[model samples]
Target: MGILLLMARERVPRVMRGEIPMASIAVERDAYPLKARLLSNNFDNQFQLPVLFYVGALLAILFQPGWPEVVLAWLFVATRYVHAYIHVTHNRVGKRFMAYAAGLAVLALFWLWLILRLLILAPSI
Candidate 1:
């Protein structure tokens, strides 16, 4: 969303300059296919993989896991920053994949820990 907003800010001048048609801003892809399009795609990405984070976080909070789980959650969020950096900047495929995989692994660990806490540890708690 921040990236989208920044892109929109940058685009205002282009729109005023008549470089990109106002009507074609959202719909017509072929008409405007470059920085603007990349920004839109990047914005769309926020909704894709991060949904897992939201679910994992909700479960973690509901279960009230220990500090280790909280650390793991923070690790996942850190990876997201790295992922976004790689995505918006250099955007190297291999680098981006590594960051994304790291985040996914952290998220998976978070879910695993939460599940264990719920099923195994919760009985004792």
Candidate 2:
């Protein structure tokens, strides 16, 4: 969504400057290929480890989350936001990696908490 917004906002200037054709992106995706590639890569990154985060979130709900789970969830979200910011902006690989790693760590912790809650706290069905 953010990438789409960025692409839409970016089109105005590029179209004026004739960098990208004033046509459908589907027809001229490569008119300004580099930015397109960057946004595309960032969009693809969404499905990677974030898939795990989504699963963990759902499990957290099913397993009955408390303060620790809630805090870890917020941390994970913050890391994703940081990762996206660095990914789309300056795009320094090192910084992007750090943010990604942080998100991964928080996700791991979230899963761990969920597992413990399910095994130790949840009443058997």
Score every model by TM-score. 0.84, 0.77
What is the clash count of model 1? 0
- Write the residue-wise lDDT of candidate 1 on 1-125 in tens digits: 67878668767778888987878867665555466666666677778768988987887787766897889989988998888777777788899899989988988888888888888888797
Name the TM-score of candidate 2.
0.77
- Candidate 1 lDDT for residue 113: 82
Residues 1-125 of candidate 2 have per-residue lDDT tens digits of 88768866765677777776567455645666666557767878989988998888888787667899899999998998899888877899999999999999988888887887788767752
Q: Which stretches of candidate 2 lie over 4 Å from their true place?
A: 11-31, 123-125
User: Which candidate's lDDT is highest?
Assistant: 2
**Model 2 clash tally, residue pairs:** 0
